[model samples]
Target chain A: MLPEALDAYVAAAREVGNPSSLHASGRHARRVVEEARERVAAALGCRPSEVVFTGGGTESDNLAVKGIFWARKSTSLSRTGVVVSAVEHHAVLEAADWLGKHEGAQVTTLPVNAAGKVDPARLGAVLEAYGEEIGVVSVQWANNEVGTVQPIAELAALANRYGVPFHTDAVQAAGQVPVDFAASGVAALTVTGHKLGGPIGVGALLLGRDVAATPLLHGGGHERDVRSGTVDTPGVAAFAVAVEITIKTQQEYAARVAALRDDLVKRVLSVVPDALYNGDPVDRLPGNAHFSFPGCEGDALLMLLDANGVGSSTGSACSAGIAQPSHVLLAMGADDDRARSSLRFTLGHTSTAADVDALIDALPAAVERSRRATAWKTPR
Target chain B: MSGGVDSAVAAARAHEAGHDVTGVHLALARNPQTFRTGARGCCTLEDSRDARRAADVIGIPFYVWDMADQFHDSVVDDFVAEYAAGRTPNPCLRCNEKIKFTAVLDRAVALGFDAVVTGHHARLGADGRLRRSVDNGKDQSYVLAVLTRAQLDRAVFPLGDSTKAQVREEAAVRGLAVADKPDSHDICFIADGDTKGFLAKRLGATPGDVVDARTGERVGTHEGAYAYTVGQRKGLDLRVPAADGRPRYVLSITPKTNTVTVGPREDLLVDEVTASKAIWHGAATPIECDVQLRAHGEVVPAVVTVEGGTLRARLLTPARGVAAGQAIVAYQRDAAGGDAVLGSATITAAARTSVAPEAARA
Candidate 1:
């Protein structure tokens, strides 16, 4: 049934038409693209004109950052500064770093608390210091690995006071949290397809009509000339469907997943009493549980769990091969050893109570084995 | 667990003993370059998976322990610092003393396990004394000397009584995955066996000179004196030929002088060496034993003495090029046959002879 929905995607994928072209087939493709934009915008509480399709979350982030920066700086070269939260995904952080490193733009990364959420007051202070020079300010809607939900509304309001354009990578938050684009009042926002059961190659940047953004990909002008390329009609349609399904079922989904996540935490802590939960206890993502077992190595525990027919990531799956301690945990003031000993368990729409139960059943022995295999100097 | 034939047989023997046994491989490599390309180290991820498969065939569980951080701090960093201070560090010794015996053993005890087992070719005598493995060619008593009594109480070496050939035959009979896995040599961290490159990366490239001690003339320019050890002779960029035209050996590394003292090969021998940080496996005090300096070096008779945390051993026969920071492991012959570990220490300094000629042949 899921593949059938993707079959419709495949049929639409075969036809190539520039949505910006004014010809008959182009108009038909344009209508399909517009319909997808409308469906997605309605689901997220935004207008159809506000939706601009991009390659994926990464390209969306790059376009939003570089575009916003260029637009702001073109108006006033003095406005060449960007402020971002320290816990942002590498897309934003790396892009900002590139600007700072080569583009003569000064980037200030705001520090986060132990819970991995940036203080709005700190953002306000930073804005006050360099408000006139600030080109763009970004903070993630929800942390990808730790599941810390940032107060995006509060951050947006603070940015508004300084007249600095704010952008949020709502990639991890789109279906998991309450993301109302119209209510948030942010100049730009980023959302990807994969995290919410959409096609992998599709995503959109929600740009406020008044906001100015330079085009990242240039060819035939498309998506209000903000992002230029032939649109993936099938991908965009499937993404719209996924977003609509996710948003409609979010409340019930969140409740069920949160309960399951809570049960996992309770069972795990019951077995390993000294397990340290990383991220905010209550204000975290519904299906994300990050924990640190003091003497047990995370990779060791992960392998043990895999041996027991359960699979979980040792922190971020993106940095899978690098055995170094997580940069995110290190930024949160965790020691190198503790950072290396942490694991991340993320649940999606496919997760079930039975899955949680299986994990809980196998966790005790796995933790015991891993702890024995890689002991530390301390007893815990 | 599966890297060498010994560990493979050890896992089998432990299972045959009716204990619920599981094999664990520690992943300590930070990069692919740090991995043992030809099956030399026991800590690679691939080796861990192989161990897991071997355990599966034996109807037991297996796991890979991520010990990258601890290995970096305890072994790699310590090695760099030791060499920077003009001492030759043994990383395998540090790893055995810290990670395998100490950290892993402690965790095994806490997990309600009676013992942690390994394939190290060393034994425990009938009186529960640490002994040399029956396989004389594979005896690892020197490295095992740092294990404390409490650690040995929960330690089991299954290959202690077996020869290397017997271990391979046993593994082949049992059809284990890594029965043919080659023994790892060189420092595990130095994948390409480039100790110079490893040290240069750790301690920055500070160029120095290797000079003749008697002539005070520069014999060769070196990347750093720290890169050259006590007995190294080749790869010194020497331009001038000695009067005898013999190749010069690095007699000493003077980090304070930023100079490598070079002389003829005979100058490398030393009759006395002092070691500290002694750890006795079964006994509380020092005892007379044969001491082995290098891993494959010949055991020489020595009278061991200890006072206030310092241990000094005077060799009955003059030893060669005994470098500081290397382990001097004491081994005694047990009554039941096989040698027992007395203890070990890090050599802090060696006595230099006042007579230059005598020093050259000491």
Candidate 2:
């Protein structure tokens, strides 16, 4: 947590008032929440009315995908299908899946190229094939696992041209890249707090006023009736401060973080010669470096590095605690074996040259041990 | 853990003993959610949930490791091939021999754990050799006898000192919901307990003759000769009553001719049994030991000898229902009611005392 955000959160949390109440303290609490919402809206280049507060990135994404799909249903039944990129976070993918399974909606997941980037032109092809049936198209601005930035501008423009709403889960790109909802021409964009520098459990979906989104939750009618329940006052305040500071310093922070990430990737690859870089080389998040080690299992390598105090991920862990092969790698045409042998090291605000040096120092022996564990174990 | 009271109590005991413990339930089924007919059963999603909840009550980390591919290749496929070769294979022994003791134990060690713990009703003595459980009625040393010395050294069974009733009581005390869970029986992969149907679907249903070994007369026809076990009497479906007014029993199965040889019950008694794929815990040859033919089956007082990589046991009293491809675990006498396991071998053939040895050949 950032010091300023932490201090503000602590100070605000000491007070007691529900932002939805009509009393004096409640009106003051409502003012604090509205100020936070306005700051978030201005920072992301959207109107204050466009910001719909929710629990976090996941909730915001669920609302945009499912809510938008439902709203489209009210206007037209023939156009009730959802088209999402293949590498979406499980949040959006699963929401669309639920809409398909239980809510009677058709879903089409678009494929990605070898670099983990969706070709913007594919939207034209999909529109031509299933135009009236395609309700909305969702493509993440930048992937969370591989950090491959998609061509969101062209993709969103294509969706708009086809009179379909476009939604982007910009949780990974909000603070790391320049994200402007109005400029990107997207109907809905999702952003969260903790991914950058804010507290968790507070985020907003930038919903265009012209875009229709039915409520995911009902009661008391919050966030233009798109999301329900009382707004989180302290959480929103801290989230606003984090968003303001991150965007203000994004250029400098990105430059320093990307350099450290690049150095870490280059030196580590040099040490482990068989390591392969994932995602797009030129177009990627400044703080993300993902790799596939030829003979090592991702979890084994992660544990080895974690023991050395270097934090990493083998894609994302599900509820079962099983470290499955990354779907992002498979979407890029990697085989199951290759997909299973992946690791992602993400740089953040606190990353430094010393951290990269530490990773480079500890990677060789860890790679050796991980390879020794799984190299012969794959034949079965 | 097998997601029963035994393993749950074993993990709790290990934790109580101040050992850093992590409970791992092996996902043996390709799809764990596939429940068997009737009640909750082995390797189903329900078992995994019970195992996880048991770990939660015990306050230890729990994980489910998917061992389906390893199990299919080692235990399940080997079982099919063995039965098709006219041998009645024990799938549990194969699981203990290949999957649990070898694959899972090796991975547990590689993952930096000291030992693998289970609910097998077998004890590891202070001498580090495996002995029969104190609960003689539920002793599991027969199936576990296939484990080598190193595997025994790294294996722990906390239920060895307690009876099944006591284990269930301990589980109840620990607030485990599966305390009264019924014990899982039969081959886990055979969901319906119909070994014949499961194998028929895999090996195909081929009709064969059930013949009288003594008279060389065909008595009944069977869908598959491999489906019959030695000493089985009820399912023979004989065409006529025996000449001596006695019931017939399956003496041997010959896969090549698809023939099942049946005769009077005496033919099923074998005083001499030969085995292969021999594994020993101590010396290669168990000098004088009690050999058990089946899991939870009788222990035959026998003299064991090994020559040219083959094991032969000469029983002082003939052993009944001895079948090929089953483990013959060797045990030695101890102060306890049951003997201590010395080693084990897979049965290749068995011989009755009076019959011409050539006639015993299927």
Candidate 3:
């Protein structure tokens, strides 16, 4: 977290009073929350009333999906279709799946190209073919795994033409990229605090004023009846500070990290010549560099790198902590071998050239060992 | 570590002794997500959690190395193949030879680790000779005898000097939660301890006849001849009783004809054992040694001869129920010190003395 945001959060956490109370202490707490909401709105270019505070990006996404789908289904039973991209995070993907299983919704999953971007033309075609039946269209602003930045404005425009609500989980894009909820043409956008240097468990859903949605949590009738519960005053205060600062310095952070990421990628490719750099070459997140090392198991590679003082992550981890091949890579037209051999190295504000060099120094040995430790199929 | 008291204490001891210990639990189960009802299995979801928790308490990095595919291909597949060929295969010994010693150890060495430390109840002398543990009842040298000399060089066994009780006490002292965890028994992959049912699932039930060896008559029927092992007295469910009215035991299984032969317990006795593909720790020669025929089974005094890559041992005293497909691990007996492991081989055949005309069979 940013030091300023952390200080604000710590200071607010010590303060007493529920924002819903009618006493003077309650009024003070209410002012803090309201002020934080306005700051969040101003930074994201959304109306203050549109900022509905949530627990985090996942909660915001769940609310925007399940809440809006339920609300739409209640009015027009025929419009029970949910359109989502193939590379969405499990939060949105699983939410759509749950709706399909329990709510009798028809889900249309649009596939991505080799670069992991959802083609806007596919969205237009789907909407034209099944416009009236579709209730919501959701595609992430940026994929968390491969770091593919989607053409959200075009897709949102296509959904708007069909009179369908568009929601984008901008959790990965909110602070790293320029994300204006009002300008993006999305009806609802999800953003969280942790991604932007704020404390975790605090986020917002930027909902359009006229967009109707049912509440997932019911009681206290907070956030214009979209979200409810006693407000997290400290978390919001810190979130507001983080949002304001991250946006103000997004350009500089991106430029610096992009250089570091590029250097790291070039050096890594040189060391491991057969390594395939995944995702978009130019349109990916500046700090994201993903690779697939053909004979190396991603789990072994990640652990070896971690042992060498370089921390990275594989595509996904099941409940048992077994690393399954990345679904993102699989959606990008890669085979199971490629998906199982991929790793994502994410650079953040604290990353440095020394860190990248450290990874470079560690890559060759880690790759060689991981290749030797290949998937249990070596001929005896 | 195996998520048991012994392994947890082993890791703790290694770390305390100034070694850079990193705890690794082998994720050998093909599907750890399967909901298991009992604690009779290893590498289950519960075992993984216990291992991770123990690592956390010990203040070391922990990882679950997924050896499921390797284990399935080597140990599990070999187990089914051996059974189909009418042999009672010990999967634990196969695992020690193939998965742990070969696969995991090779990976560890490549990853810059000095040694792979385990919690097996076996000792390695200062001169690097493999020996039995102080805890005789829990000694695991028989299974570990399958490891090659090179693999043994990079292996560390920390719980050899202590008994099971001592390890449990150390775990309790160290506040490891698995201190009271029940010891895993039976085949781990067979969750319910139903070996026949497990084999039947893979090698589907092939109906066969059970014949009485002495009378040379069909006595009963079986779903699969692979399910019965030599010397198995229970579950025979024999339809015809012997003339002496004694309980019958399985004598042999012939997979080609899908026939299981049964006889009186006296016929199960064998004074000579022959094993193939012998592995000797150092020098291979004729020696007077004790041979353990199966895991946790009795060790018998025998004169062992190795020739043409085959081991032939003549037992001084006859051992009942000696079966093929089990290992015959040779040991040099040392009463005051733990017995040294000479080497091992897979039992291929066993026979009684030819002088005993009525009982002898090959």
Candidate 4:
């Protein structure tokens, strides 16, 4: 967390008040929440009325998927199909899966191209063939693992043409890219707090006023009767400061991190000549440097690097410590071995060139030993 | 870890001993069965869940390391191939040799862990020599003898001093959910205890003649020679009794001709056993010791010697039912360290005692 966000959070955490209550203290809390909402709306190029505060990014995504699909059901039960990109986060994908399992929602995961982009032509074709049946279409603004940025404006325009509600989980893109909810023309945009130098447990779902979405929660009818439960007044305050600072400095932050990331890639490639850079080389998140080491398993490499005091992540590790091959890499025509070998190095605000120096110093030997360790398989 | 009370309590004890312990359960099988017939079989979904629950209760970080590839190649496939060669392989020993002590332990060390800890009922002395567990009923040193000196040095077995009952009591005290979980038995791959059926499915059935080894008289037919193990009396389904009117047992299975040889109990007595793929710890020597043919089988007196990585054993007392492809684990029988495992090998052949005069009827 940034020192500014930490200070704001600490200062606000001392106060005790509920925004839903009608007392004088509650009025002050309500004022703070509204101010935070206005700041978030201004930063993201949306209206204050459109920002629906929820617990976090996952809850916001779940509400957009399940709630929108349920609302569409009331108008036309025939519209039960949910269209989502194959590279969506588990938050959106699992929510869609739950709808398919029990809520009578048919899901169609549109495939992606070699760049991890949902092919616009494929989405257009699906919209033409089953536009009337597709209750909602969702594609992430930026993939978390491989850092491939999606062409959100083009996809959202197509969804709008077919009159289907479109949602974008911009949790990874909000503070790093120029994310204007109105400009992208998505019916709903998902953004979170902790990912943007704010406290956890506070986020917003920017729902267009004309768009129709049912409520996922039912108590107190908070946030324009969409998301209920006591509003996190302190988290909202901390989140507003974070969003304000991140958006104001996004361009400069991107330039600095991208330079460091490029340095990291150059140094690492010098050490590991056969390492394959993943995702789109030209158009990717500025802070992400993902690579696939040919002879190394991502888990082994992660452990070796972690032992050397460098923290990194594989494509997707479950709670069981099982490293599943990246679906994004597979969608991009990578074989199972290449997909399994992927490692993501995400540079955040706290990242520095010294960290890159440390990673480069240990990466060559780490990869060499990691490959040799698993290579001693006695012949069957 | 086996996800049993022993491992859970062992992990708790290690943590209590001020060692920075991490609980790792080996995911040794792909597509673990969601429901197992017996109590908490290995690599089942229930076992993984139970392990995670125990870790949670113990307040330690828990992870399930995927060892399915290594296990399938080393233990499971090796088991099928060994049976195909007419040997009764002990998959538990193979797992202990390949999966636990070698692959999992090496990976743990590479990942900055000092030692690999498990729930096996064996003691590792301060001098790093492997010893029998305090409870002989639960002694696992025979299977663990295949571990090298370096592996034993970096391994910790906290349940060595405690009996199975004490381990369960410690698990209850630690609030582990698997305290009362029943111990798993038999081949883990053969969950239903139907090794013949499982092998028939994988290796396919080949009809073979079951003949009397003494008189060469045809007894019955079997679906597959790979389905029978030496000294097995049950499932023979012989039509005629032995010439001496005594029960017969399987003496040999020849995969080449798909033949199973059965005979009277006297033919099953063996005085010599030879083994290959011998692995020795400490020193290789011609030593008089006790050889255990199977896990928890009888510890018969023998002179076990290793010559050029092959084991040649002369049983001081005649032993019965010795089968090829079973592990012949040599143990020290001296009073100083009773039944301490010396080394082991996979028996390739055995020399039977001379046929008894009373059983030589045509």
Fnat for the candidates in order: 0.33, 0.15, 0.31, 0.21
Model 3: lDDT equals 0.89
Pairs in clash, predicted candidate 4: none
Query: Which candidate number maximizes DockQ?
Result: 3
Candidate 1 per-residue lDDT, tens place, A1-380, comes to 24534765776778877676799878887887888899899999889999998888999999888899989999998999989888888899999999898888999999988888899999999998998799999999999878999989999999998899999999999889889998998989999988777888789999999999888788877679888777888889788878888888899999989988998888888888999999988778899999988977787777667766787876553221345577678778888889878888888778888888888888888877777666454433
Candidate 4 residue lDDT tens string, B1-362: 56778888888999999998878888776656433554535877667778888889888877677888889899999999998998898888889888888888776665557888889999887756788898899999888877877778888988877889898887877778888888887677676778788888989978889999889989899988988888899889988877778889999998888899998777787878999888777555778888898878888888888987799898887677888888888887645554577888888889855553433531
For residues B168-259, what per-residue lDDT tens digits would candidate 2 score against the true structure?
88888889888999988777888778888888999998899999989898888999887898889887788877899888899999989999
DockQ of each: 0.19, 0.23, 0.42, 0.26
Off by over 4 Å in 3: B35-38, B354-362
What is the Å distance of residue B282 in model 1 from its true position? 8.2
Listed in order, each prediction's TM-score against the native is 0.67, 0.86, 0.95, 0.83
lDDT per residue (tens digit) for residues B236-259 in model 1: 768888878888888888899789
True contacts kept of 4: 0.21
**Model 3 chain A worst lDDT run, 10 consecutive residues:** A371-380
Q: What is the lDDT of residue B325 in candidate 3?
A: 95
Best by lDDT: 3
lDDT of 2 by residue, A224-308 (tens): 9888898989998999989988998999988998888888888978999889999999899999999999988887778667767
